[model samples]
Target chain A: MTINSVPSSKVRVRIGHLYGDLLNLYADRGNILVLTRRCEWRNIAVEVVSIGVGDRIGSGEFDILFMGGGQDGDQQFLEDDLFRVKADGLRGAVHDGVPVLAVCGSYQLLGHYYDPGTGPRLAGLGIFDMHTVHPGLSVRRCIGDVVVDWIGAPVGGPSSVVGFENHGGRTYIGSGARAFGRVVSGNGNNGEDGTEGVVQANAIGTYLHGSLLPKNPHLADHLIGMALARQTGSAKLEPLDDHLEWQAHQTILDRRASHVAPVGGRVKGSGGSAR
Target chain B: MRSRRLRTGFAVAMGQIAGWVSRAVGRGGGTALPGLVVDYLDPSALAHLARQLPGGVVMVTGTNGKTTTSHLIRAMLEAAGWAPIHNASGSNLSRGVLATLLRHASFTGALRVPENAIGVFETDEAAVPRVLRDTRARVLVVTNLFRDQLDRYGEVNAIAQQWRDAISALPGSHDLRLVLNADDPTVSALDGGSATTIRFGIGDPDVGRDAPDHASDANFCPVCGGRMRYIRVTYGHLGDFVCDNGHARPTPAIVATDIQADGWEGTAFTLKTPRGERRVSLPVPGLYNVYNALAGVASSEALGCDLEPIASAIGTFRGAFGRFERFTIDGRRLVMVLAKNPVGMNEALRTVVGRGGSGHHVLVALNDFDADGRDVSWIWDADFEILVGQVSCLTISGHRADDLAVRLKYAGVIGSIPSSGTVTVLGGLADALDGAVSGAPVGGTVVAMVTYTAMLELRSLLVRRGHARAYWDDAGVNSPEVTAR
Candidate 1:
């Protein structure tokens, strides 16, 4: 499925979205499709099992863990489910180290609880030191292009990246934690910074839902490499053909370029050829 | 007034002259721009000129099921034997409102109606507060709110807060009754400081959940910050529940109980309230229509309409334009379920599911341009998850056919035919509508989900073919084929 390179191994990503169905989960599921298909386009086989209400996911069972924004009831339903499923245990598996990407609700659930004192103080997987507040406004909606600088990467190149940022929850960047990037255009931390996206180790979480990978293929490659690296004792997922996926990624790239003109306005690359 | 109307005939000639000029200038030629042009024209010109000659206005707005709710409210008042002036066409804009008034007004700008009637109109979500300012509506009804058109209407919470502010500014003693959706915490919060705060919802606890639907709104009470609990959810964050901070929870006064689906084609329910529990039937399918009916009953009650007429009119309710209207386009019978947003599409799909088998083709036109969310990301949120293989052979089109096709694929349905081109999308709507009635192995069941702006395009097309008619004058007789569903 890789568009510009050799085919990579298949991976199954189960999108636990049913909670969204009940707890108002729309944004999360959108990220899953965008990410899963973006991975598939790189010729990476992604078997997506959208687990709704009463559905369960196993650790190492998923190459990447994902969640979306939902109403407090969404978190309400998962209060115990995350504990029973050991969201922490799953994240522990990620730290041991499986790459986990939780966004909005998933990100919020990765650590601490919401509606802290008054509302139901449900537990998250505690993967991060993050705590969120409910009854907050859906004020943070990042339109147009998103650019971020990556400080650390298993496979390094440029520090810059682009995507969409949309969410109401914000992380204060607690002890041992750090702000992913200063807002390039729209809101970030405290959400007034125009912060675009976030990343901590292999677990890259963002409020962006342009199928993050489609807009940032390098990260997709990095995560794929990291996942494969864990499974094969090698960092790179060899024999990768990303031709079709690169083209698919181009779908958003072409789309976004029209909206958020790239760094220098445009990157001149042959329509069908690789840079 | 009758004498004034006779004298106003001269001015009516002038307004008609304008209308005729616009028609001649192609403003009504059915172009995309023409509709926009008509809308851009100040509807206030008509509303302002008629303000002194008529009864005050009644404005209704919310995300889910507002059209059906507005229609039911209008009917209840009419049945109560009042000449309720209303826009039954489901057009909640200033243009539609002006057109409605123009149709009833005379030349010198005098309203022909007597003063004993009520003006029942459904205003758009963002347009309500502004429209309210223009007309002194004694009773302002606020149905529950959910996320809609994220691009245009910022946040659901923001809108709910705006509603609260708007209600607070209303004239002190006009009986500003707020009909709050019990399930939504964000909406109920606006109930404070109102002359009358009556809460209505699906009363059966068995129907609700501790959590909410994938697209529920207002999880916690906006005030007090306490966890807003739900006894049941009709859909989204709408249900019966209260907060610890004395914030408004689901008020049990006006309740909808025994909300059961009759073959899921539509709903039959017990309208339980302090007045009495009445068994009501809604021909419109989905749990949403149940809410729509309840909201209608509550508003009609506020206007002092008799309960029986409200119930009867709701029972006889055929449904708003494509909200769930059944029609025969080109000798083919079909049902048009307007699935506008993620929450809407989910409910629409749920209704289609209740109808039992898709047993018919489903045509979904997802317009993801500005009118539709520029971020088609919400389509993934649509409960298309409900109708995986149930309704086989889904034909997809619209501005973003690729996105919808991709969405259907993500939902695990394969081979979604992306309408080859833009014209094909329009063609697809007709083809799918026609396919519903084609009747082969599958029965006459074609469901189409279109966006708000697309509905204008869709309605005009349906009207030209005579498959659809304006719901106001179209109901009761001339369109039995429409209600045959």
Candidate 2:
């Protein structure tokens, strides 16, 4: 089948990194870097504008909106900014079918609310139909290397994406939302559900942040292609050699598999357990 | 007390046997294993062993520089004619301290050293409370606190709370002296109500940066919720900072002034303490080491050591192993630097790129083991972008080579490499080391920036290759052939 193509016209893909400085707890800026480099490699023009607290973005300013995780203290400070300054702009961007990737803390903030178990419930942007809550007093954070089978992409995405997830909030997808993937290993969203992340409209929210992109080139390319398609009406991105990227992704998968306990075997205890 | 001493003696004997058996079986140093066995046999082994030191115990705990600072203090004390026992194996855990103490103890559970022999220990940040609960420490030297190992220790504030609780619970008669980093707001705020606190910092404004880096932590004032305005940010959130509410960095009792950081050659500075001013030419690179040296000076002075010998000892002190140790192999130079966090990694990268010569090679090894903090995402926070167009070649290695390779690629380092082969990713450390060494031009240096466990692994590989001595076998600071540059 001949793939539909459009003439390359130096398409400018703008990305607005919300809370680029404050909410970068897990190197989430790497995701923005990955997006920018992947586009530059294809001769596509890319621009990234950092939108921190009190910073505003125009409705049509960016093709992709990226948000990363931050410390609990930072999240508490950013909650007011997200609602006051960025909620409308980001909501319009998502409504325009612009691709959004929010990880960890920002992922929780994209939902309706985030209840951190002890403090006042934080208001979210209500972009994705979901809510996150702390796993209560007795439960620890759901953290480790995670592997998931991709389920939200239309076509040509990878069968699986591997990354690391470290978060205390367990998100539950609401009735209007859909899960981005099926959890293959490690806790996702919550340990109870075999689901990881939320996919609503063109926005995706996840806890996976081994930077979330460099290892999963397909997902990175998918978001890039979606951004380009939105810009140029229709486009097919030329693929770069991802041999090393696949190697890295497969390595994480293998590591996760090895770390997972065998069926009915002894559970691996948390770190700091004396031998 | 007699029965308890007898039990401790029996435990020490068993621990020694265990250490011998483990070493004979080629299972590495087995330092912590002996302590574990001892603790299992006698729960009071650490307390009993710690009580034998006539000079009392000194505890050093912080997020970074704990090992190096404790080592420097130990060296200063030794130079002053005091035999100091320390956990020199880079093992700062409770069991590691117990094992070191047991090694110095006689078979009768009595310290075998001289009467004035002291005990200096580097305790893990999270393990400080537990260590203080057992031993009667006379001095507690907290270097600084940053957000590290979030998966292991919840958050910076949580760890600070733990430390506060630990300090509050100290006995009324303990008379503890606290040596803290005045620049680090989180660490400086950890002053216990009754303890005598001595603050140390860098007073040289010339060495400070114009602004804080992206990964700088504790940017807000601890006293007020106002944003902190830094007058001079040496590195990260360290240096002189003030808040709108009039809260400012504490006046450090011991400060390094007139700083001259000569890159890899060494840093020469004049230390101004309450006692007097002494010029200290520390044979180490990076401002972090300067801070570590200042911490050592303040800590030693707090313990009543003379200023001249302490400054002289710090001047000659080479850094702790893997902190930044230089070695020459096959006409190529290897500088091993430990980069466990973003702040540390950025400093290492700055030191490397600041070398200013071409044909420089960097091999970054990352591991997600418990020791190295299972989350490897902090690599993104490190400013590897500085090396994008700078280095001639780059190699990514270790268990998480791909993750690092991806980070480097996104940082624009890989794309800037003139050739594809220059940005190679080798999974095995042995192969990566061999490739990096051979790949380097003759006389060119290969900076091996590695994490904690990876540093250990790389050092072992070097030891096997006859490149360096085993850390356990190396003598103290005055060991011959151990030079500054």
| lDDT by residue for model 1 (B295-373), tens | 8787776666667777788788877777777776544456677777777888777777766654446677876555465
Q: lDDT tens string, model 2, B273-315?
A: 8889988888888889889998998888889888888988987
For model 2, name the residue pairs that clash.
Answer: none
- For model 1, what is the C-alpha lDDT against the true structure? 0.58
iRMS, all models:
11.7, 5.1
Expressed as tens digits, the lDDT of each residue in A195-275 for candidate 2 is 999998888999898778878888998888889888787758897988878988988777765765411111122221110
DockQ, all candidates in order: 0.13, 0.36
Which candidate tops DockQ?
2
After superposition, the stretches of candidate 2 with alpha carbons farther than 4 Å from their true spots are A1-10, A118-123, A260-275, B1-3, B192-195, B419-421, B475-485
Query: What DockQ score does model 1 reach against the true complex?
Result: 0.13
